[model samples]
Structure formats: C-alpha cells, structure tokens
Target chain A: MRTKYLVGFLVIMAAIAYLAWGGLGKSLVYYVLPSEYADNPQKYQGKRVRLGGLVKEGSVQFNPKTLQLKFIITDGVVEIPVEHEGTPPELFKDNQGVVVEGKFAGKVFHGDNLLIKHSESYKPPQQGAKLKPEEVRKLLEEAK
Target chain B: MGNSKRKLTDSLSSFLLLVGFLVFLIGQYLAFKAPPDVQQGYLVRILYVHVGAAWTAYLAFIVAAVYAILYLWKQNPSYDRLSAASAEIGLLFMALTLFGGMMWARPTWGVYWTWEPKLTTSAILTAFYVGYFLLRQAIEDPEFRAKAAAAAAILGVVNIPINYMSVYWWRSIHQTATFDIVNRKLHMDPSMVLPMLIDLAAINILFVAFLRMKGAIAARAAAREEIYD
Candidate 1:
C-alpha cells in the first residue's frame, strides 16, 4: 500500500518537472498581425520570424549568379522585401499568397522559407502573362 | 490473477517510475539550456518540448489503436484498459502539440490559430479520443463499452495521417519540418541535437510509465468489479 502511494507521487513529480522546465526557457510565444509588425518594428528586429502576405508581381528580383533572390511580401497594408537562396517552391509565383520565415536585416528579409498557399478556387486568378494550369504542370514536372 | 504477487508488481513499477522522473528532469534542462538557434535565436528551443510532446502523442494514439484491435481479436478486458490508458496519454500529448504549435506560430506565422486543415484535423483527433471517454462514461456494461471503444480506436486512425499530411495537400496554416536532426549534411550543433535527443528519450519513458500506472489502476478496478459480481 505504501509503495503504491509512493510511486504515484513520483509520477506527479515528473510531470511537474516537465512543465517547470518549459516555463524557464528562453522566450515565450507572441501572436499578432502584419499591421502590428509595422507598429513596433524595433521590438521584433533581428529576431527570426515568419511574415504572411501575397507575393507582389514585378517586385521579384533575382541575382542568378549568387542565387540571391528578392521579392516583396504584402498584406496590402505593408510591403516587405524578402531574400532567399536555393529554389523557391514550384507554385511560388507572382501574386501568389505566401508565408515566409527567416530574419529581417537592412529593411529586407534574408528569407529561409517560402510557404505557398494554393487557394481552392477562392478568387484572384491572375490575368495574362501568368502560366495556365497546363503550363504550370509542365513547368513543375520539368523542374523535378 | 493473485493478490500474493501484487506487492512485487507494484514495487517493480515503482523502480521504473523513479528512473523515468530522473530522465524527465535531465531532459527538461537539456531543452532549456540547449544552445541559441543558428537563426531563430532562443525561440527555436520551443520546438524541442513541443515536438517531443507531439511525437509522443502520435505514438500513443497508434499504440491505443493497436491495443484496441488486440482486444477485439481476443475478447480481453486488459487490452481495452491498455487502450484506454494509451488514449488518455495521447490526449495529453495532443494538447501539448497544440500549445507548442501556437507558441511557435505567434513568432513565426503572425497568427495563433488558422483554419488550416492540419490544425482542424488535429482538433478532430483530440475530439475523437475525448469522445471515446464520453462514450465509455455512458455505458454501464463493461463488455459493451470495450467493444464500442475498440471500434472507435480503429476508426480514429484515419484522422491521424490526415493530420500529418494536411500541410502538403492543403493550404495549411502549419509549417513544414524545418531541420532534420539526422540529416548528415545539415547536422544541428550539439547544443541543439543533444537536448532534443534527451527530451525524446525522456518523453518516451514518461509514456511507458504513464501507461503502467493507468493500466494498473484500471486492472485493479475491473478485478474488484469481478469479485462483487
């Protein structure tokens, strides 16, 4: 009887230890919107974070040699430049909505990611100069 | 089956229980003191615990389904109880997953929760298990409850993979796996990998220990019912 009670106590202790450890960690989570980013720019400066918005057409610039790609991410209210290396996702294109994460420096993001959102027959279908479904499929298949 | 050996079983479980607690402490510290992330600085540390909990929860759900299947095959109450125990831990782990995910999201995604399919599926998975418990509560017959619970576990497996692959298939609010701990080319520094491994080990142990205790409690209760009936 005594042993059973003792074991239960130990289990409870372990659970507590886990929670306490998490609490003492380096930082906590912060939730907000894009407009918030513009409000207190300095508070979030130099920290790694993700920004979400639509890809701005004509804003993308690529230095093919160095693979230093640059583009603008916009929530309509704010537009921020993003730089990334390697290959962007197949669906990543102009006017496409995306979420990017990395660090912000010199008024631009050295982006480590580009997560594209494929809207399901939602709305904006780019007019003219954009790849249609067949061309898009062919492009992706060739890249692979 | 015999009371004479009850003391021994209880005592042995106590020893495993102690070891588990020690591992939990060391793991938590490792997670806390782990080095600043290469890019994210300190915010990346949240991944260690959050990922650990999420992983364990997924494992618990799978194990619960396995046990449920076994119960249905052999008509064993012990199997049902084991499934119940695993489901309970799975629920706890799923909660941890959501909390860790939300915390990570705020800094990274600029949103706490999204209507993304992955988050939605995860909510559904947790609800399924919570519903299992509710279903059990309404039934008085142990045999009937076991059958119903087993069926629920089997059906719930469909939601697990859906939660996992939701990001790939849908415009999910969740992010993809960032760094692979085992990728030789993209090796994480010791400060990062060490704590992650330690936490993983600790959580795995915790899962087992939880199962043992809950399983025993359920077993004893059923045994008592047998005597009364």
Candidate 2:
C-alpha cells in the first residue's frame, strides 16, 4: 500500500512538472533596455518584450477624450516612442522609470500595459522643492 | 487545572480578537484620512489593505508549512492541527489579496486580470491551497489523512517563493517589492507607509487569534474522535 501511494505521488509530480515546463517556456518574455533594443530592433521586432527605461522629460501626451497615451522612453543613449491605448497607471509620470510590455511595430512600440517602476530608495523632496502646478501646466502645454 | 488552562486560552484568544478589531478600525481611519497620492490619488488607498493582506497570507502559509514539516518529523497530531488552522486562514487572506488586487487593477491597469507571471503564480498558489483543503476532506482514515495533508502542505510551499519572486524572475506587469527590508527603506512616501504598517500589524494579530481558535477547535474534535473510538 505504501509503495502504491508513493508511485501515485511520483506520477502526480511528473505531470505537474510537464505542465510547468511548457507554460513557462511559452510565457517567458525577455526584459531589455531601450539602448539594447535600439541596437537590434529588427532582431526583437514582432516578439513580445518588456522594455524598461525612464520616461523622457516633456514627452508625455494624453488625450483624455480619446483615451490615448503617447510617450517616449529613454535610457540616455536611445529613445523609443511608445503609444499606449487606455489610461496610464496612476504612478506613471514624465521622467519616472517605467516598464512597458508589448511588441514593436511600424517604428513604434505598441504598449498594451504600462507599469511605473518607482525608485527603490524613498527620499521625499524638501518642502517647495517639487514642481509647481503652474510649471507642470506649462510643461504639459509645451509638450502638446 | 486543565479546565483553568482552557479558560485562560479562551480569554487570551478573545482579548486578541478585540485588540485586533480595534487596531483594524484605527488603521482604516488613518488609511482613509491620509493624504491622497500625487500620482495614484485616492486609488492609492487600496495599497494599505491589499499589501497588508498579501503579507499576512504569506506569513500564514509559511507558518503552516513549518508546522507541517514538524508534524512529519515528530508525528505529532498537534502540529497537523496547527498546520490546518494556519492554511485555512491563509486561504481567506489570499482571497482578500486577489479581490483587492482586482479592484485596484481595474482602474489602474486597465484590466481586472492579466496573464502576467505574478498574477498567474498567485492564482496557482491559491488553487494549490484549495486543493490542499479538498485533499484533507477526501481521505477517510485519520492517519492516512494527516500523512497526506502534511505531504501536500510540504509540496505546496514551493509555490510561496515562486509567487513572491515572480515579478523579478519574469517580465511582469505587477510591481516589485514595495519595502526593501534589507536596506530598511520604502519605495513610497512615509505617509503611505504609516497606514500600511498599521494594517499589516492589525491583520497579523487577527491571524494569530483566528489560528488559536481554529487550533483549539481541531484539538477538541480530535479528542472527541478518540473518545468515540
């Protein structure tokens, strides 16, 4: 009876292993920087990938009526234009680090999802150090 | 003396439950009253409960796994009872985490559920524990049931680390670790951290109370079974 139970357990484990192997293989997407992607855009084009970089300053444009968001992701060396449909995440902002998952096509990365990657360190800015509302308004106007 | 010990334990559990409830109310008040995030605004409030419940679920699962290993090693029925109690509470919190996450995600991520690694792994972990409970209920003989449940508990623990590290291990839409314990720093503002810490503490105390109550009930049921035999 003990041997019978051990065999059943082994069989169950084997089946689980088989399923996990296949699921992971099909779902795994590579995480790459903008510079790395720019170096060989054609090589990764049409394949699902996660690109991580800072959102370029003064590049964010959102049309609330259309629910369209356009931004340029930069790694200081290269910039990739990303167009996303739907509302951007709450934490998403200009000059913040972000990771976008989607495929590159037609000279633009079509992002289906946007995730704001906050800094690991928590350092609140000094009082009055943050950008003023007027300055933010000006920047958005300039971007438009 | 035996009756006195039981009375003491009952009083202790009740005290824990009352304290946990008061703490939860305070935490909720603070969470709602805290300043809205500059980026997420009011939506950021969900982080307090969502993150707290997720952390508590992980804690409960770890406790269950540890007790399961002890049961296997010592063949102690008490450890098995503790494992079951903790796992049941873990499942409850895990459900809360998933529900809170979905509600938070709908407005933030533009979708309720995605096939991302972190989300998928969490779902898998929840399902595995559900299976753990079903397995416990399926077996007839007490010894066979305990042995099978312990083995399942041990095996199911592999999913815990997988669920936690899924974000880093793969390209996921889910955010990375919010708190850097090794560095003693937070990824968000201190204002946000305060309420989250309160909720986390409150949920942990509540978990302890629930586990003790559940453990006592299981012990009594086992005692009754032995008497019948």
Candidate 3:
C-alpha cells in the first residue's frame, strides 16, 4: 500500500510539473517599456505583449458613441500609438501611467485591455494650491 | 475538571465570536467613513472585505497544509480533523474573495472576469481545494480518507505560491500586492489601510472561532464512528 501511494504521488507530481512548465512558457508575457518595445517592435509584432508607459499629453481621443479609444503611450523617449475597441477606463486620461495588453501591428498596437497604473503613494495637493473647477466638481460628485 | 474545562473553552469561543462580530461592525463603520479613493471612488470600499478574505483564505490553506504534513508524519487523527476544518474555512473565504473581486472588477475593469494570471490562478486554487473536499468524501474508510486528504492537501499547497506570485510572474491585469512586505510599507493611504487591517483582524478572529468549532465537531463525529465500528 505504501509503495502504491508513493507511485501515485510521483505520477501526480510529474503531471503538475509538466503542466506548470508548459503554462509558464505560454502565458509569460514580459512587461516592456515603450522604449524597449520600440527598440524591437518587429520582434514583438503579432505576439502578445504588455506595454507600460504614460499616456502622452494631448494624445487621448475617445468616441463614446462608437466606444472607440485611441491614445499615444510614451516613455518620455518613444511614443507608441494604441488603438483599443472599448471605452477607456474612467481613470484613463492624458499623463496617466498605463499598461496595455495586446499585439503590436504595423505602427499601431491593437490593445484588448487597458489598465491604469495609479501611483502607490498618496499625497494631498500642496496646501493653498487651488483646485481646478473641474476637479472640485468631480470631488463633489464623488462625495454624492 | 474536564467538564469545567470544556465549558470554559465554549464560553471563550463564544466570547471571541461576539468580539469578532463587534469588531466587524466597527470595521464596516470605518470602511464607510474612510475617504473615497481618488480614482476608484466608493468602489474602494470593497478592498476591505476582499483583501481580508483573500488573506484569510491563504492563511487557512497554509494551516491545512501544515496539519496535513503533521498527520502524515505522526498518523494522528486530530491532525486530520484540523486539516479538514481549516480547508473548509479556506474554501468559504476563497469563494468570498472570488465574488468580491468580481464585483470590484465589473465597475473598475469594465468586466466581471478576465483571463489574467492572478484571476486564473486564484480560480485554480479554489477548484483544487474543492477537489480536496470531494476527494475526502469519496473515500469510505476513515484511514484511507485521511491519508488521501493529507496527500491532496500537501499537493494543493503548491497552488498557494503560484497564486501569490502570479501577479509578478506574469503580466496580469490585476494590480500587484497591496502591502510590500519587503519594503514594510503599504501601497495605500493610511486612512484606507486602517480599516482594511481592522477587517483582517476581525476575520482572523472569526477564523479561529470557526476552526475550533469545526474541529471539535469532526472529532466527535470520528469518535462516534469508531464506537459504532
């Protein structure tokens, strides 16, 4: 009985090892900075990849009716145009750090997922620094 | 003396349960009173329960795995009971984690479910433990059942590390861990951290109470079965 159990355990462990190895190989997508991706765009083209960078200022275009989003993600040195089919997340906007998952194509990344990466640190705005009217309105709405 | 000792433990367990419930109420109040996140808004409230449940689930499984190893080494029935009790509680909290995460995701991520590595590994962990319970039920002989459950628990522990590291190992949509233990700092504001920590404490207390109760009942059931045999 002990030998039987030992063999069973060995078989199960082997199966698990095989599955984990294969799964990791298939699912492991390296997170690349925009500059890194630009350096080797052809190498990553048509392969699933995650691109992390800041949304370039004045590069956000969204159409609510069509639910289309287009933005340029930049790492201060290189910018990549990203076209996504869904509405951008509520927090997604110019200058926000974001990580998008998709495949790179010719001069555009067709992203399927957009995740806004917020800063881990939270500091209140400097005292006496006036809040923009829109910012105040947004805060009031959130309070409601 | 034994009767009085049992009574004392019973009262102690009940007291713990009451305190846990009260603390949970306080946690709820703090959760609501805390300032909303700048981005997530009121949705941030879910983090209290979600993170608490996830942490408890991880704790439960680790405890179960340790008890399983002890049972296998010493062949102690008490260790088997402890393992099963912990696994059951772990399963309950894992379910909470999944549902709470889904609810949080819908509004925040625009989807209820995605094939992200963290989400996928969590689902796998839940399914593995569910299989553990089912495997335990399928066996007829108590010794064989305990042995099989122990083996399963030991094997299933592998998923815990995989689930924990999935966010780092793979490019996942889910955010990374909230507490950076290495840095010894939290990733959120102190105001938000306080309520989450309180909730975690309350849940942990509740876990101990539930484990004690469940372990006692399992011991009784095993005893009765032996008498019938």
Candidate 4:
C-alpha cells in the first residue's frame, strides 16, 4: 500500500509540474516590446498581439469628437505608431508605460484596448500639482 | 477530549468570530475613508480587499503545509484534520483573491483575464489545492488518505513562493508588491497606510477564527465517525 501510494503521488506531481511548466513557457512573453516586434514585423503583422512600451513624449493626439486617440509607443530603440479608440484610462499620460492590444496595420498599430501599466507606488496628489477646471470636469465625467 | 476543554474551545471560537467581524467592519470603513490615489483615483480602494485576501490565502496555505509536516512527523490524525481544514479555507480565500483581482483589473488593465506570469502561477496554485481535496476524496482508507494528503500538502507549498515572486521574476503586466516584505519597504502613501494595515490585520484575525472553527467541526465529525464504527 505504501509503495502504491508513493508511485501514485509521483505520477500526479509529474503531471502537475508539466502543466505548470507549459503555462509558464507560453505566457513568459506576455507582451512583446517594440524592439522585439520591430525585429520581425512580418511575424506580428496582421496577427492580434499585445505591444508594450512607454508612450512617446509629446506624441499623444486625442479627438474627443471622434473618440480616437493616437500615440507613438517607443522602447527608445524603436517606435511604433498606435491608434486606439475609446477614452484612455485615468493614469494614461505622456511617457507612461502602456500595453496596447491590437494588430499592426501598415506602419500603424490599431489598438482595440489600451492599458496603463502603473508603478508599484501609490500616492495621493502632490501638494503643488493641480488639475485644471476642465481637466477635473473631464475626469469626473469619465469616473461616471 | 475533556468536555470542559471542548466547551472552552467553542467559546474561544465564538469570541474570535465576533471580534473578527467587528474588525472587518472597521477595516471597511477605513478603506472607504482613505484618500484616493493620484493615478488610479477611487479604483485603488479595491486593493484593500484584494491584497488582504491574497495575503490571507498565502498564510492559510503555509499553515496547512506546516500542519502537514506535523502530521507526517508524529502520525497525528488531528494534525491531518487541521491541515485539510486550513487548505479548504485557503481555497476559499484564493477564490476571493482571484475574483477580486479581476474586478480590479477590468477598469485598470482593460481586460478581466490575461495570461501573465503572476496570474498563471496563481491559477496553478489554486489548481493544486483543488486537486489536494479531490485526492482526499478519492482514497477509501482513512490512514492511507492521511499519508497521501500529507505528502501532497508538503509538495503543494512550493507554489506559494513561486506565485508571490512571479511579478518580480517575469516581465508581466501585473504590478509588483506594494508592501515589499523582502525589502522591508512600503510604496504606499502615508494616508493609505493605516487602512491597508487595518485590512490586513482584520483578514488575518478572521482567518485564525475560521481555522479554529473549521478544525473543531472536523474533530467533531471524526469523533462521530469513530463512534459509528
């Protein structure tokens, strides 16, 4: 009975280990960096994939009337133009780390989802930093 | 077991439950009263429950692993009961952690589920404990069942460290730990610290209370089974 149980336990553990290893292997590259995607554009072209990088400074363009937001995602070495629909998350800002989920269309990556990659730090608003009246109204409207 | 001892444990369990519930209420009030985050704003409030539940789940699994070791070392049936009870509670809190995380993720991450390292490892952790119970149910002989479960419980704990470290080890979308236990540093604002600490304490107290209640019930069930035999 002891030997039988030992063998059974080993078999189960092996199976679980295999399953876990497979899961880790597949998702190890959760989002492809801009440089990696730039290395082989054909590999990700037309394929739905997540592209992660910092938003390029002074590159954000949002049209409230069209609900279209455009930005350039950069890894400092390479840059990819991203066009996302819908309002950006509250944390979204210039030079913010973002992960855009979509496919490449020509040189532009059309993103259906935009996610803000926030830092581990959580803080209240700074003493000197203040939101403009319109900005506060916009934020309140978005919160609703 | 002495009848007086049993009565004492029952009263202790009741007292802990009452205290745990009261602390939980206070913790919720503090969580709402805490200031909003500069980035996430009101959404950051979700972390009070999400992180607390996740921490408690990890605690439960580790406690289960320790009890499993005791059962194996001394061949104690009571230890086995306690180990199983702890794992059951761990599973419950793990569900809460996963569900609460999704609720937090939808508005923040733009997706309810993603195949990131932290999430994948957590899913694996949940699966192992679930299999632990399934294995327990499969065995017919009580002694053999205890022996096998003890082995599995010891092995299952390997996932806890892996799950906890997944964010730091991998390039995942999930944020790193706000309360870095290893570095002994907190990354939260001053206003939020008290509420977070209160939530953590409340959940931990509730976990201990639940463990005692569950263990006592398990002991009673074992006693009844033996009486029938």
Best by lDDT: 4
lDDT of 1 at B106: 62
TM-score (C-alpha) between model 2 and the true structure = 0.78
* Model 4 chain B worst lDDT window (10 residues): B1-10
Q: Model 2, which residues run further than 4 Å from truth?
A: A1-19, A23-31, A48-50, A63-68, A99-101, A113-144, B1-9, B167-171, B188-190, B223-229
Q: Kindly report which residue pairs in candidate 1 clash with one another.
A: none
Q: Residues B1-229, candidate 3, lDDT per residue (tens digit)? A: 2432454247667888898998999999999998777776787888889989999999999999999999999999999999999999999999999999999887776668765678767766886787677677667778999999999988888898888878767776677778765457778887878888999999999999888888887887787688789
Per-residue lDDT of candidate 3, residues A56-144 (tens digit)? 99998877779799999999999899999886777787898787889888889989988766554432234476899999999998545
Return the TM-score for each candidate structure: 0.60, 0.78, 0.82, 0.88
Shift in Å, residue B27, candidate 2: 2.0
Q: What is the C-alpha lDDT of each candidate?
A: 0.71, 0.81, 0.81, 0.87
lDDT of 2 by residue, A1-144 (tens): 345444555554554554366555544553578999878878888988778788999999999889999999999999999999977876677898787889999679999877765433333345466788999999898566
Summarize candidate 1's per-residue lDDT along B1-229 as a digit string, tens digits.
6684665246556766788778878887877776555334576777778767877998999999999999999998999999999999999989988988888766645457654566666766776677667666656778998998899888877877766665556545565443332232324565566677777778888888888888998898888888899
Write the residue-wise lDDT of candidate 4 on A78-116 in tens digits. Answer: 999999999887678899999898999988999998887
Which sections of candidate 4 miss by over 4 Å? A1-19, A64-67, A128-144, B1-9
What is the Cα-based lDDT of residue B206 in candidate 3? 95
Interface RMSD of 1: 15.5
Task: Calculate candidate 4's fnat.
Answer: 0.51
lDDT (tens digit, per residue) of candidate 2 on B1-229: 2643565258889999999999999999989987766555687788889988999999999899899999989999999999999999999999999999999877665568766678777877787787677677666677788888888888888888888877778876677778764345578877767888999999999999999999999998888788789
DockQ for every prediction shown: 0.03, 0.21, 0.21, 0.43
Can you give the lDDT of residue A45 in candidate 2? 83
Of candidates 4 and 3, the better by DockQ: 4
